[model samples]
Target: MLRLIAATLCLRCQRVRALPANLRSCATLSSAENRHTVEALYNLSVDIQKIRKLKGWVLHQSPVYVREVADLLKDMGASGAIVARILALHPEAILCSPDQVRAQRELWMSVCRNQTELVGIIEKFPASFFTSSSHHVNQRDNIAYFQSLHLNKRIITKLMASAPQSFSRPVGQNEVMVCTLQQAYLELGGEEANMRIWLQKLLSQNPFVLLKPPEVLRQNLLFLRDKGFTTAELLRLLSKLRGFVTELNPDSMRHTLAYAQDTMGCSEAELRGIVLECPALLYYSETILAERFQGLLGSGIRMAQIIETPTVLELTTQIVNYRIQRLRAHGYDIRTGSLKPLSGTKKDFEMSYGKLQLRRERPLFNPVAPLKADD
Candidate 1:
């Protein structure tokens, strides 16, 4: 019955918007008696479990209203918990006419394809249903335009998962943005006709890149290009992790670069090398980078070696400190391996240098901050 209401009345109710001053002719509009029944059910005392069932309709459920709204959601696969959560976050959503909610739910289900997917997104963004069906239609058009790009399903899913709000843009605006990006990628060169496909995939993997205005993406590439990254290097960075360009703060990148050259004694060429190896280093706090370099030097690792093995920069201060202290306690020299172990995984570290068997006799590791040794 609820499904029937969702399928038949959703768009029809949306078309009406509101009952006219003379609703006498409209057959589907809930009568005053229906409102009274809803109020009666709402006031009826019930167990906590049943309360969950009534949650979405408690505040505003005429017989017709409950049938169309809450039951529609339940029919679409929203659990009692999900229904409760949506109501608690936006109880006034129940005040919306049943038709609007049916239309909205139908729209969500069309793209999301399942109750779980719909619920997961709602959990993350509880206000998703706040907008009217008109807003939803616009967003739906944006998604349809993306599909029209001939992108693979993997790319589409990834993009939507990363930045669901992209669906909220006006359909016309989204069409323009997609066209702008498509042209940019085509001119990006390489793979000829496949360049646009590559660009779509790149944006999907690095959804944060799409959150920025299209101009920002262009400006970032230009910034890196002017900073001596060749076309190949810029492409590598954009493809691997576009956020390196988009999330980068120019001041932060510069300060880290200066620290690398002046304080750490890395030459210009070496700094560039380090960035290519680990572009994320530019975003690290100056203080931590300095401390890590100091620790390495204090342990007899050469500055030139550190520059050559720039991958070691990915090591956190806590992991390095913990490893170094453990090595010294067990009479092992920290510099014996030239910090090669720094690039190894946690399992490798624990099995080879960590001596986990011995650690068992000691206090437990703190899961909250595993970097800290036992007090």
Candidate 2:
């Protein structure tokens, strides 16, 4: 009977051992189901976030936070039913408040004890899990948060370097105008073309230059009109131009002086002297100067008076000759005179003639009578 009792005890112990094994198998299955369910939910969240991005919603938080939460749920080893129940109890509670996240981290540490692998997993969870702070709402704050992840500093630097400097000061309106004018001036050709371009550019840049637009036009008309440019054309051109001084080229001044001399029927030498003495007048060339000279002369204006008082006689002679030539070329009757004179009687000539006549009369009277008497 004692032997029978011993066999029975052994059988009971064996059954108890089998019960523990069955419980362990059930727990393992539950843990695997919970992991699968959590993974699915996390995947769904990711899909939603992606959709939000496609819809142009700003993702202010780091993606790693979501992933870390999913990983933690996977490591929990809870049953799918239990996980579903937990999620249902507080639908969005997986994302803990900052304070709650910190508490959870502390609890995880206590539960994990000195397990290195568990500690590693806890460390991998996002810092956001420990704080409810919405610092990520700001892009700069978000960048700082990412840097805290021990990412490569070089990568951050490179990203910053690649970004455009949008904060730099914008070009001023005045500066823009100046730049535009400069470009136009460069594009135009010839002296007149250049002047037009320059004037336009200057005016466009600074409207103040044309404070008296009509007056400016009148002045330009008067000046250019005198240089043989048609008054109407001068008016049209000045109306179109903007800046006066900025468009003035030193070389253009020379050409203008030449034109003025030509129009005024003045010699090149005289024009050059005038330009040297009064540089302001050298705005037209010989052609224009000549035309102007004929106009003035036709109006019965005297050349001597028009040429400044300081001009030498030689310069006046040149001016006269140039005027005569131009007038003749244009089919106008022009009379010219030389500096020298033709043969004419003078007081000295008469005195010399009288002396010669007295000498000849005395010789004829005295010599002729003696010769006849001697014969």
Candidate 3:
């Protein structure tokens, strides 16, 4: 349903703005309901022209209760402008019956502390709040189920907003996935007391993990175990990947490992060390690895340097080239120096460059001179 709405309601502001005012007004004035919806929205200071450009279909669809939606949002402490924006962005909200909106409000209030927080969440993620009436039962059950697990309310709210599909499914499906994750954590030698924290963090980091089948995680773990990863190493990998470990299947992982081994001429031990250092290498396609490798080699970086700082492989070729060029201008040759400078984010590279600049410009007489008061 969301997909259908998304496909139909693409916001082409430029094209919509190009339409003549007469045509726009005629479309909105074609029916009494449309005129009423438009007048109510206008009264709330909604940019009718903008909404018409984005979702003119709402004006055409009858039985739209813009006033009811406005009243609900206003009751939740939303200002007039917010009410207008919400309607404009997600006009489908007005299409839902008053009963559905009230039910959704109550459902959200279960996790949200008060009206202020509820309004804030709606302001940020309107779609999550104004879902179909059909999902009400599943949403209620899933919320209760997650609460029963002792997961944080904030995390549950986030899951609903970001991964609504998780909450829309029956509680049994999420239960199975959660069990699988807990089992995997225990099997990896995670302590009993820390299981809740681990599970909370995993779900918080990647709620869509609930959507994956239990068998995929089992297969991935088994494949890793067969590839000589001990339980301890597996735990570390899981921690490093932040619950995205389930994204890797045996076949893709096998192909990636083969490519990395062949390209780097590294033995099994060396490859394991590399993967442990940067788990992305286990999931990165051979094509992407080849591009990054070529980017580094093309910059005169040696194979040994890459082996030493495997994390640099995470950076794109464009970023690698830009950093290398900057370092060369600063007379810090990455070809001879360590690849550490290029291993992190853009800010990290700038900090490393600043340190290099300070080292290059420091006065040689500082050692012979007296220290200043501040120094």
Following a full C-alpha superposition, what root-mean-square deviation does model 2 have from the true structure? Answer: 39.0
lDDT of 3 by residue, 1-375 (tens): 998777656656555676555445544354534666776776677777777788778877778778888898898899988887787788778888888889999999899889998888888888888998899899999999999988889889989988999888899999999898888888889998998888888888988899988898889889989999889999989878867988889999999999989989999989999999998898799999999999889989999999999999999999998888888887888999999987887789889999988887887776877787873
Clashes of each: 0, 27, 0
Residues 318-352, candidate 1: write the lDDT tens digits. Answer: 77777777766666665655555555567777676
Task: Give the lDDT of residue 190 in candidate 3.
Answer: 94
Error of 1 at 18 (Å): 35
Top candidate, metric TM-score = 3
Task: Give the candidate order by descending lDDT.
Answer: 3, 1, 2
Evaluate all candidate structures by whole-model CA lDDT and list the values in order.
0.61, 0.40, 0.86
Tens-place lDDT digits, model 2, residues 251-337: 566567655655557886675455444433443455545565565456454566456532222223345455445444434443332
Local error of candidate 3 at residue 339 (angstroms): 1.1
- Local error of candidate 3 at 340, Å? 1.3
